[model samples]
Target: MTSASPTRAPGPFSRFEWLVAGRYLRARRRDAFISVISALTMIGIALGVATLIVVMSVMNGFRDELLGKILGLNGHFTGFPIEEVFHDYEAVRDRLEGVDGVIAATAFVEGQALVTSQYASSGVNIRGMSIGDIEKLPLLYSSVLYGGWDDWDNLEGVAIGSRLAGQLGLGIGDPITIVTPNGPQTPFGSTPQIRSYPVNAIFDVGMVEFDSLFVYMPIRAAQVYFRLYEDRLRDGVAQPDLMASDEEIDAAYERVYTATAVEVFVADPDATARMQLPLEQATGRPMVFTDWKQRNQTFFSALQVERVVMFTILSMIVLVAAFNIISSLVMLVKDKSSDIAVLRTMGATRSSIMRIFCITGTAIGFIGTIAGFVLGVVLALNAEAIRAWVSNTLGIALFPPEVFLLSSLPSRVDPVEVSVVLVMALALSFLATLYPAWRAAQYDPVEALRYE
Candidate 1:
């Protein structure tokens, strides 16, 4: 070994290369300008990543929150008759129960009417639903904060939305009148049907659209109001019995009351599309099936488009930071030309010289990405609190339910999306190092140290 030293092993880049790379990254007072530029580059990358994470997470949160409220109130799939009321709804509902992916199937009647209290009047959508169904639905059950479900089916009882109650100056036990557009046709003219019912319950679904514009009535009451009576009655006409048996009239009433639609809830809404054909086949009737996605396509599409546009615009921040990385590395190479030349003269290869600068630049990106990730996660986790603090301090309301349709700001982070951002930042920063690193490697040792 003394006579002839064993050949040294070779690697792509050795320990010596890493040491030099780390040393160059360390801030030195003599290179104050370069050091400051390097720090700014890192800060720039960090801020960019943080902004992207926060914005993307907020958008995701908004979509999920809106979908939950809408879907919780409106089932995943609904089957409505083409034009006629579904007179054979029981048979249809029974058939639907056999369909795959059907969680719960029930009959529902929907209609539009003008509702008035002593204080105000407004047009609202009235849905006729069974009290048993209401009890089974967690959204409806949990929302009934004021009254119990015992009196929901009493022909004189109704459930109104909290916002609707407030607007009409009505509360539990207050009398509210519903007037439907259709009524019994008389010889002179048609008159709208009016019925007064006490507000048995108040529900708040936390959605402005539903809260301000919907009310619920017993299915039997809705049938009478909408005039879904037996075919024995003449067109939009009601006949009182003079000598006919009450049992015959009651049997006729039972035969006619039917649902306008059948609402179907599924275990997984995303897979509801697969249930469409099966459900239609099971119904064996000409029916229209509308999924939640189809019903709210425009709104969801707009949200997705806005999210993409915001991401593209914000990614420019990271791109700008990448350019800063390029500038700093270029300056660093120029400042250390003599040192690189010295290493080259001492048997260091050109590739090793390139790797040194690459490591230095990537370190900045790596550390910056980690810092931004942590900061963003923390901020998103405490978004509501931060929103409240900012709102209180600024004397303003950031999310007024009446205006924005949501009670507060929402934020949700997807780990996959976060990982993508991290990888993107690192990739951009690594690419930024290439040109400067190659230039440093190509310098002539003699020229670099000619006048040193």
Candidate 2:
């Protein structure tokens, strides 16, 4: 009569496929001891990944912040004439602007002078720049805290940094005298002269060293105050007798006879060498050029080392969690020997047996790692909020400006870093599955069933 209905074949991963393997992992939860150990392992992986992300982001943020501050206060690159004064700075500037990666170029005179206030005095590096050109360097404009640089007219006025103003107890429109090394000559003899300049404005650059040690002045004022000019040497001759006043003569001689040096400010902060080449070649004098990175090598180097050390130390947590995975899987193998033997009798291949346990172990690691990554990124992204919350709730300051230079916590989560950490977590988890999977695969059906 009709053909017998073909028996339905069991699908891959049917009840029989998972039952033996599922029992091995479920048994862990049934035993309070195994359950605690497994939970701790997951916690360890989560904490490890979270800590690594947060710490790495913080370090990266600090590095970026520091670089910004440095580059802002100091131009990306500086070039100087090989000779004391660049006779053909216009030509040199033009040539530099034509260089590859060169953005803009400006010439400046850099010198050291004594800055004095009513109550205090400190030595500062005076930079002579054109107001129009200086404006191109946005850092200078943004850093102006108390007064505007526009006030630096052809008049004898100067812009001091915020730190310098505070240390000197000076403020906007304060009268601070700048005494630069000058020379005066008269019929009697020649002597050094000093000139005074009123503090016109103050800028807060947030960098202590630069803020405390730098002042900007109009090019002519600096040339006059420091007497850096060629008028004192008329017709290539040293004229000590051109004294209207002894003070005038000495200052003029100092300005004219002394060589003039030009400090070139470039647009591209990284092309220190490229910009320097033309200036040195054109001037026929030895000029030194330096970039922002080279200027702050020590600080950046320390930060880099700290980042590596912190990452290395924190990874131990992940390693310990991996050991937990190993221990859990090993125990599962021992407890599931009879089940593994039964599966073997049912025609489940050894490779299939291995796959089951491997999947189980990997699942544990994947869950913990994914959870940790999500939580870590969330925490990192909202670090500022977390800091604020902690401060308000606990009544404790997290990052004090006086101590940290920044008033708030900094964070910068990188996608690449997160991906690497996730992959590493999964790899460690997969590694933990090996020995146990192998042990389960080696089980002999006859021997396993003989005992039962």
Name the best candidate (by lDDT). Answer: 1
List TM-score per model, in order. Answer: 0.90, 0.78
RMSD of each: 3.6, 5.2
Kindly report which residue stretches of model 1 are placed more than 4 angstroms away from their true locations once superposed: 1-12, 231-255
Per-residue lDDT for 1-452 in model 1, tens only?
34432222366556787789899989898989998999989899999899889889988898898998888878888898877667888789888878777887878778999999889999999988888767656787788768767866775588888889899999888999999758889997888899899889898877888888988888888877887766555445456577768865554443467788887888889997788888899997889999998999999999999999998999999899999989999999999999999989988878889999999999888888888888888888888899999999999998888877877788899898888888999999999999999999998999999999
Candidate 2 vs. true structure, TM-score: 0.78
- Per-residue lDDT of model 2, residues 138-241, tens digit only: 77777777768765656678888777888999977678887755566778776555666677778876666677889888877776666665653434545566
